[model samples]
Target: MKILCGSAGWTDKTLIACKRFYPADCRTAEARLRFYASQFPLVEVDSSYYGMPSAANSALWVDRTPADFTFDIKAFRLLTGHQTVRESLPKDIAMAIPETGKKNLYYRDVPAEVLDELWRSYREALEPLRNAGKLGAVLFQFAPWLMCGPKGNAHVEECADRMQEYTVAVEFRNESWLNDRHAFDTLELLRRRKLVHVIIDAPETVTNRAHTLWQVTNPELAFVRLHGRDAEKWNATGAPTAAGRFDYDYSDNELAQISGPIRDVSRRTAKTHVIFNNCREDQGQRNARTLMKILGR
Candidate 1:
């Protein structure tokens, strides 16, 4: 089994601003990506979740990274049932929306034709990565309110169907999906749909937090995203930036403790992707490197 360890995204304001991970010469986007790939075999594209990814940028990623390197892209906010801003949408698509004075748009707010176009464009943009065999998986991280129920199940199935051509990973933020009552059903659902179950490591003390489930639904791939255990930030009120929410760093003992389950899950899948989402400054980069050493990858 192959275990690929890396960070959620290469470009983070604090990661670059801290001047700890990237070299002094690695100022350009291309340079940073190239340098990151040299250190790790995998990475997750976090920016795509905020806005539509461009085909040109996708092609540039393929050209910049090595052949064996791969990227797991986060699905667009609209596709994942997240509240997206008008500016995040394409200019033409945003114009299509009637002047309803709505600043935020959800999946239901978008017209059928416009949504179809979005799905098509999203798929087309990632074609370069898929064609070059650099695509890892399209991550569909459902919102916390998406509880385990019929409607939620249907939405999950729909997302899998939409990205049927590519490898899809599902991450549920709600605890209901993996609680004692519905854990079995949730795993079964993913297994039946051939969707990779994303195992997350997050603050256990927080309400509605998804507990770390070591179960692997897809034999082809198992995804693990480590969001450091900082209950205060995770449970904070008001709007919290990505960095502030996932700012805690993993200690050596913490990494060693989790390595066992990670190794066990890797054995059952063809490949396992372990992504560090504790993206405060260079925390993820440093933690991922340490985990790689622990796993002897």
Candidate 2:
């Protein structure tokens, strides 16, 4: 089985502060990336979800990492239909849009021209990685409110069509997308579109726990993202941010329980990517390394 194990992102402040994985000389971005590439073959670009990435930076990344290293980039906030701040948009995009004194803009609010520009820029930014054969996939994780229905399906199809040149992975945060009645059909939809279904392990007590379903939808590439089971903070409205929400470490037994399923999925697919999203400290990295040891990868 072709299994790639990694953490969601390498730049977490907690990972740096822990001073466990990186050497002191690995301080700058290039040094850190070089060191990280030495340790892991894959990494997910979580920062790209917060802001648009530059082509120059992407090219620099290709130069810094080894040829075998691969990157899975998160889709930009706007592309995934999240509530993005008006100020977060690029200057050209902001100027092109008609401002109605709104503080935030949803994917629906953006004009067609602005959306096209944003999509074009995102694809262009990834060209360097793609050319170097370091680009694994572009992950499109939809918001919790994006339920299963005609509208939701349309949006998913539109995203797939726009990025048809690249491999796309789809992750749904909403429970409605996967239930007893909808699970098979939803998986079939992703299969038909050639979208890699993102399997996740998160707190099961949350209102949106339906996303915990672990079925494989695409045979080309399967993904498993382990977000530690922190039930208390999973849906805590008082929590400051996602950093707090996903703050938990997996025990040996918990990780052991997942090992079988991961191996099973990897055996059936061309490649399987297992990423840890529990980035509270070095917790995600630690758990990911532990899993790698368990799988003997």
Candidate 3:
């Protein structure tokens, strides 16, 4: 089994400021990526969720990393039906919006043409990485409000169709998608579409939206994201940033419990990506390294 381990983002501010993961010389973006690539085989690009990535940067990443290094980029917030701040979008995309005064816009609020443009822009941005064989999967992590049903399922198909050129991974924040009754059905949906099911390690509570389960829908690639078991902040609506919500760190026993499932998934899939998403300071980076050692990778 080809198993790769890494953290969500290498360029996270806390990971750099914490001064525990990267060396002092890894100050520049290029240097940081190069160093990170040397240590880990894969990385998840979380910044793309905030703003569309650039082709130039993607190309640079290819040049900076090792030949086997891979990047899994998150879908743009607007593309995933999340409430995106208009200002964070590209100038042209933002200007095209009818309600310029509004602070945020949902995926449904955007016009068809504008949404198509956004998709085009994202595809183009990732082309460089794809061409270089540095791209793993484009993650479409839908918002918690995007529930399970025919409508939600159709949207998933639409996203898959839009990115047909690349491998797509789907992560649902809505627990309804993975409830006891719908879990197997949802897995079948992903299997039929050849979409990588993003198995999550989050708070094991119904209200948390994300369910902590061991499921592998895609035999080609099993992608696991560990967001830690921070139940207190799992549904904390008032949290200002992602770090606040994913604040917990895994203890030794916690990692041991997850290790078994990861190994089981690895045996079934051609490749497995174990990504630690607890992006609070150096917690994720440390845990990723720890998990790697635990898994004997």
Model 2 C-alpha lDDT per residue in residues 1-297, reported as the tens digit of each score? 888999989888988999988898899988988998988889999988988888998999999999999999999988898988867777888788888677888899888988899899999999999999999989998988888999999999999999999999988998888887798889999988889999999887777755666667777788998887878878778666767877888999998889999999888799999989988768888888888899998
Q: Which rank order by TM-score, best down to worst? A: 1, 2, 3
| lDDT of candidates 1 onward, in order | 0.92, 0.88, 0.87
* TM-score versus the correct structure, for each prediction: 0.97, 0.97, 0.96
In candidate 1 the C-alpha lDDT for residue 247 amounts to 88
Error of 3 at 34 (Å): 1.0
Question: What is the per-residue lDDT of model 3 for residues 79-166, given as tens digits with 9 covering 90 to 100?
Answer: 8988888878889988887884667898888889998998899899998899888899899999888888988988999998998878
Residue 175 displacement (Å), model 3: 0.9
Q: Candidate 1: misplaced stretches above 4 Å? A: 239-242
Worst 10 residues of 3 by lDDT: 205-214
Top lDDT: which candidate number? 1
Candidate 2 pairs with clashing backbones: none
Better of 1 and 3 by TM-score: 1
TM-score of 3: 0.96
lDDT of 1 by residue, 1-297 (tens): 799999999999989999999999999999999999999999999999999999999999999999999999999998888888989988998888666677788888888898888889999999999999999999999988888999999999888888999999999988999999999999999999999999999988886677778999999999999998988887677754545789889999999999999999999999999999998899999999999999998
Candidate 3 lDDT at 218 equals 79
- What CA root-mean-square deviation does each model show from the true structure? 1.1, 1.1, 1.5
